[model samples]
Target: MKPNAAATAAALHYTIVPKDLAGHIFEVTLQIAAPAADGQVVSLPAWIPGSYLVRDFARHIVQIRASSGGKKLALKKLDKHSWQAAPCRAELTLTYQVYAWDLSVRAAHLDASHAFFNGSSVFLRAHGQEDQAHVLEILRPANVAGKSWRVATSLPELKAKRYGFGSYVAADYDELIDHPVECGDFLLATFEAHGVPHDFVINGKVPNLDIDRIVADLKPICEAQIALFEPRTKTAPMQRYVFMTMVVGDGYGGLEHRASTALICNRNDLPLTHQSEMSDGYRSFLGLCSHEYFHTWNVKRIKPAVFVDYDLRLENYTSLLWVFEGFTSYYDDLMLVRSGVIDEAAYFKLLAKTINTVTRGSGRFKQTVAESSFDAWTKYYRQDENSPNAIVSYYTKGSLVALALDLLLRTESAGKKSLDDVMRALWQKYGRDFYTRSTARQGLGEHEIAALIQGATGVDVARFLAKYVYGTADVPLAQLYAGFGMALDGAQASKASLGVKASRDAGDCKLAYVYEGRAAHLAGLSAQDVLIAINGLRVTAADVADGLHSAVGRYRIGETVELHAFRRDELLVVRAKLQADDMPALSFTVLEQAALLRPSWKKTTRR
Candidate 1:
């Protein structure tokens, strides 16, 4: 059926109200104009997109009931997330209450101060009517505490005023859940990028928040990404975009949506009115913004084949996340440099940090990037204390893979083609007309990426993919950097190390992770062991704060020392041989004369 015809058909209407602010409950009412002949089946999603974990969102539904024509209808539980209502001829309505206390971006959170939620966490999907339009009515809270709250979402307004609580319309169920809603008296700002308006909304108390500075910094980054995907037209896919952020004392994360992104960051990450210089926290915050913004073209649209129709009921596995997520990671920081937000030195520092992160884990040698992508649901998202020793991150290593591919493409094609060309090709073939041409919405195949790269850049990368992506071989980043007129070297630490990461736990030095095959592991020290002393010297939590390795730096390498620690209230002593610090510390420098051959490597063309 045509898109408009499907939309004009009887739509599924929903009304959501922030009821019981102190109790953190949201009452949702779903009305189906044309209920199924036998029965209507509805279900909540098992997980939100982007974050690859089965959250079982339906578990949060507190109470549910069904009714038709003022008569109560029998409802039967179908499964953990699905339910079926008895056959009804008249319009069917189901009301349920959701317990929304999750404070992260993926789920719902509500309190006396503010209310935020993703549709997947609140709205129930009418199984058969997913193609029809979905209308949402957000009612303002009745209590006096929420008198000044406003709504911020990318959902198209139907009868409601912009930023006012009322009704909104979505193309279908897929589009409905793609926009997260934030209701509060938020700090709002607007800017245009390539003639497209972008909204920035902040939902926490931030004294002296510099909204102007943020707008200025974000404009160029958005324009650069738009140009990257559509260089000739410089057009953006969405009519309007939003960056909905929630600020707190100390937090950092972001979840990408179709036209908007939900982010949480520390209050200190935001620039103050009097601050002039860029701080590390601010740079990191900008990088996070850039990363999610790039997703506007990458995974949000150019998805893996398995994601073409997301089975939110179960896990969706794919091995191509290295391209979808990893490539985006590589460009997130590069866009900063290309937009002139940061210079070469700053960009190199960020790049070096990523390289060191990937190199620090021995798990990289055991797991391929493709394996990491496939096991994301199991290992990456559900990480534990020994995660670093057991698994590799598709994000960090995938970015390195992207870097290697870009450098190889540049060298092989004489700089005529690079990863940029491949990305543009992907956008053109798989992403550009995705939303507009609904009939042709298809995702990239897992094994087809190698062919796509060859066709786009005229460079065969099958062997490269075999060695770096499918195999557990490092990307040889040092050689790749040298080819781009840059030198990559590791910096040695000045402190001796126990090769164990520690944190202060109630004034005790708690070992968080003992590196595999390192000094601590060889000495039989385990995670969760609280250190009491080292070589008869009392070790305090303050020593762990200084650096676990620094506390042991006083001893010489290979020197034997007595270590006293508490394992579950049991005191134990063991002799340990100190080793040199082996944490990866990478540095990059430009080879000026060689770099002159490739100016694009250092700087990108700005619009």
Candidate 2:
């Protein structure tokens, strides 16, 4: 008979304290239940999942030591993140100090006012004892006294209040590391989704925040996702969920977890106390939230095969980000419309924005989505100024692939089968019993997609995947949009261009990125060039865009114009002819949209 997980598990206890708040250091003490007969080896993870690349977390360890049975044991460093201790018969104890300074969703950060950390940044995994239960004790900061400080996290409480300084428990090492903790004088609010409690914890200053609006806007989204996965029961997989946001002057992104998400957004992106109209920034923030929340099912649980058991020591490569991240990107904004927060017209506009962004870059023709996903660690995460000219984003183009598949499935099955069906099929087949039973720890592989789609929907999508996902062929958007009573109005009028993306910098127009094979590239106009004149006319950054466009306004295609710019302190002049560029500007309008009501899928593009 198998030993019970709760009863047979050895407990690993950890005590954490804000040792030096001004210096941003955390003092940690880990008590091991037992030590190895041989010397025990402990290692910190080289990287965290969801975000690719090796972070070398152990580099933050400032000091470390090991002891057992009240006697200090000799500790030796074994490589980067691993440490070995001499043989000990009694329970072992390890103490360390970590320097916390990174202020992003990926790592740990601490200041005099606030403290936050991910388990990957502080906890060291005990080799060969990963399945044992782990417990953490959060102590009140020694430096600060009576500051109304509170702890917020999704980790289960043992002898702690909901948001107090005390003990928390995790099923194992993996579960323990998945929940990030934030302690500060935060703004806290609570709401219930399908009777499950969700805590909203904000760590920055947003003046007169409209908490009701946030609760109202996010509640429907949470409920809809719950109903999507567990339709009959209307239940969520998590017992509790937390949305931990850090508001700043200007920042935006998020990272997902099992039952919680960490987000960073600009202060202006938050809705005010009585704001009626939705600003573009607020919409973008909502999209970011939706994207990360969708990962609760897509990437966090329904993971790529290689990620089922993450090998944190190295890069875990998979070509299925088109399904993991791409599909979630496609649904992030679409769910807003379906959930009644946004309208269909607004959704179509959002879709057009994505389409324009993807097509504007020249790299879509050079790199496939699969290649982009595979090289994400080296290329996407470490992008530079020439990124658009060399590589494509799996997130952007991958969403288009998902859109194409949704259209294909809906059209082929007469509106009876949509991407919704495919997702439900994915959950039922692979994700339903994932955490409930350890034996069914399965993830989707690259070779399994075509067969799975065919088996679930009785439609063969091998050619579709080959043309768009694995190959660099663009999806037939114009043809597909027409099938839904939408007209793709490709722009005929062109805008005057230097074939470069420039921004106003220090009263001068600076080229941010010069497209390859464009007029700017041919004229030797490099990125970082500051434009001062066009055809002997003075120009400043504020008016350079209009000035340069007006300077070449009268010139037709194939016409040449002179330009002056400074690359660093040196000045140069170059002449280049205008080229007819197919600006990726598509406008979607209503054609037979009058009949938007009661539309059928058994319709082809208006040929």
Candidate 3:
């Protein structure tokens, strides 16, 4: 049995103190029953759901005191997060404090301003009997008087007024763990689409960024998903879809929830008119938001069997991460185009970037998508220097695999069907009215979706999955792209007269990487050499390609330019003649067909 196999919780009470310690600290209390066995132990989870890997939540447990009936029981630490309780025959309570200093989404912190908790750090599970119903109550600072800041969570909010936010009821331990609660001073924004309520609980002041514009832009993506799925079944399970985010910092990402998601992001993610002029960070931020939101349907509900009933003690292996995470990745950007957020050229540009990434990664040759997903605990989650050489990313390869399968379906079906149909089919079979009944009691099964895809796609996908997913064989990229009207013109040694690919490495201008027999090599450039300046202009790795491109962008074909570099710890000038280069380019063109063909599964492209 797992360490906390029979862990359960009867009730949880949380209070947000905005000014507890000069406006820092959030107090949390857990009420649980003593396990049946006298020698048994209770503990907190080292990590939360969705995000695998132990965080040693005990490190943040500042004070922990256990008591039974009306008398205090002496608790002794057996190990991190687990404690041996003194002899007791009555109910017990555990109270602890979590430091809220960091303003990030994944952990708990407290400061002079607000509080954030990730549930894993503060909520305790009853050692046995997880099926028992649970409740959570939240309290705000009494002295700090102001209109109640918005309360948001995936769990249903009870109608109560005194403590800013009321209690949440969970059918059992599984439901309690699935829903994460976050409360702080924030701006609450609401929008409606398809008659479903969408709420945004945002932190910080009136966003200097355009809030309404961001909502308007995401409308189509949401509408398209609803339109496709609702056609299969009119009444879906979801009622309130909440999106929570912090608007202060530059680095950002998100975690998906059943009816809501929490995102940590920057201001630039807002869609601006001069989008091209926006920084690369902004573009990547939008991609993350799109990815997490898509998970509501694909991952949160339609899940793999391995993930259906999560084992909180250790890693739960699933070969279908490529299907779950990767397919979602493929759609994150495509939805942008389908929703008219971007144009075809922009869409291809994004696809081209993924192509470049997959082609360049060395791990693709070593690990298959299935292995990547299964070994995610040891390999994917804990990335190191050698990761580039030994391990493939399930997320990246999975996305490409999803793309290949979609194109194959399109080509084989003669433009009559699509991957979209596969998604709709899964929803119809699994996603019934979640609110009417209790999804709390009925956890999802992954095999159901897998079985549906096998019947729909007509490929013994299970066998293919067993091989490429379970085994470390390289995916047949060359074959997969052909049917999709795309191709991977295999990488050839560049003739740039330089052997090195220069890029900004760790905030400094340096030789990022080197390939043998290139012009930079012939010119005598070695790796790790700082490139202080190029062509008499002080340069970093970021400016190398663009700077090189700009020098040739203005001139007609056959233009020549002199390049200077800091080579061999010395400033050296090397002259590189420009050539109309097609060697490094990955190109896709539309083939002319006799008649207009719509995007579908069967129609073949002539171009």
Per-model lDDT: 0.89, 0.83, 0.61
- Model 1, 165-246: lDDT tens digits are 9988887899999999999989899999999999999998999999899999999999999988888899999989999999
Model 2: per-residue Cα lDDT over 45-88, one tens digit each: 99888888789999999999999999999999999999999999
Runs in model 2 lying further than 4 Å from the true structure: 1-9, 504-508, 537-559, 579-583, 592-607
Clash count, one per candidate: 0, 0, 30
- Order candidates by TM-score, high to low: 1, 2, 3
CA lDDT, candidate 1, residue 365:
85
Top model by lDDT, which number? 1
TM-score of each: 0.97, 0.93, 0.78
Worst 10 residues of 2 by lDDT: 593-602
lDDT of 3 by residue, 346-422 (tens): 66667777767665556667887777777877888787544655778888778877776666565566655567777
The candidate with the higher lDDT, 2 or 3, is: 2
